[model samples]
Target: AQSVTQPDIHITVSEGASLELRCNYSYGATPYLFWYVQSPGQGLQLLLKYFSGDTLVQGIKGFEAEFKRSQSSFNLRKPSVHWSDAAEYFCAVGVRRDDKIIFGKGTRLHILP
Candidate 1:
């Protein structure tokens, strides 16, 4: 089975500061990684995903993630975060598109003024 872990349960960043959220996965083979954001009372929104091709993938809302095979990590980063970026971030891993995706516990992002 595949699993994902988000080390940080909560993260706080200034309104315009850079942000990085750690994500690690445990899988025997190359697995698909996805980053999703959920605002308060909102549904999950796909931020970025890593399946194949480039290791570094860009996502919506000025977010990007780098897939490190050796480290089994797919960390998400943003140059400058906005107040609206505050939400719950999730890391998911799956073997195939049709397979069930396993999500992390989720990390709550806090925006500080």
Candidate 2:
């Protein structure tokens, strides 16, 4: 069974703080992983993705992620998160965008003043 997992349900951090959101996946074959963010009451937007070649990929909104094949993890990281970065982040693994995109339970980020 191919699936994406996000262990954390919520995380809180102050403005201009470092952030790391964990993500894990189980797949039978080569995995195509993706990180997506969703603002309140809005559709998801792709932050980053890993298809092939590079192990570490840079994403939009100053976000990046490293793909670890040994651990099957693709954790999202931000050096200094802003208040506007507060959103629900979701991890996905699948064949393609229109195909079976298995998404993990999202992690909601809270920004403190």
Candidate 3:
């Protein structure tokens, strides 16, 4: 079965510090990668996605992710993070055949002053 893993359950970073949330997926063929952010009481927002064409994809809220096939990773990165950016990040993988998406456990980001 296909699965996703977000190694960090929680991450704390100072204001203006760079942030990186790891995401790894296991699938036989090429799978779709997605990054989503959910605020305290808000629905999930699509941060970015990598279906094809590009290895590095840009997302909303000044976020970006790089897809590395060899590593089977689609890690999200932000050069500088803000307090407003604090939220729960989820990495998802979608298979073409079943049209189903598998989500990770989720990583909660904490911003510090």
Candidate 4:
């Protein structure tokens, strides 16, 4: 079985400050990883994904993540955050093609100006 765990349930950061979210996964082999953001009452949008190759992957909205095989972790990082960046973030792990993706409960980000 494959699973993903997001350590932080919620985070608050000041506007223009840096941010990081932690994620850990358990899988048999290299699995498809993705980070998504959802605004209030809105659907999720893909921030980034790691299918294969490169350990470090970049995504939209000034977000980036590094895949560490040894640590079984893929952490999201942003140099600076904006008020608009405040949203719910979810980390997912995709197994088989026909298998359903699993999403973490999500971390609510609050930005203070």
Q: Which prediction has the highest TM-score against the true structure? A: 3
As for TM-score, the candidate ahead, 3 or 4, is 3
lDDT of 1 by residue, 1-113 (tens): 67899999999999999999999999888889999999999999999998899999999999999999999999999999999999999999986746888999999999999
Clashing residue pair totals per candidate (backbone < 3 A): 0, 0, 0, 0
Q: List where candidate 2 sits over 4 angstroms from the true fold.
A: 96-98
Query: What's the C-alpha lDDT at position 60 in model 2?
Result: 100
- How well is each residue in 25-107 modelled by candidate 3, as lDDT tens digits? 99999889999999999999999999998899999889999999999999999999999999999999998899988999999
Give lDDT tens digits, candidate 2, residues 1-113: 78888999999999999999999999877789999999999999999989999999999999999999999999999999999999999999986545889999999999998
In order of TM-score, best first, we have 3, 1, 4, 2
Predicted structure 2, TM vs. truth: 0.95
Question: What value does the lDDT take at residue 32 in candidate 1?
Answer: 90
Off by over 4 Å in 4: none
Model 3 poorest ten-residue lDDT run: 45-54
Per-residue lDDT tens digits for candidate 4, residues 18-91, read: 99999999988888999999999999999999999999999998999999999999899999999999999999
Our tally of clashes for model 1 stands at 0
Model 4: weakest 10-residue lDDT segment is: 96-105
TM-score of each: 0.96, 0.95, 0.98, 0.96
- What residue runs in model 1 are displaced by over 4 Å at the alpha carbon? none
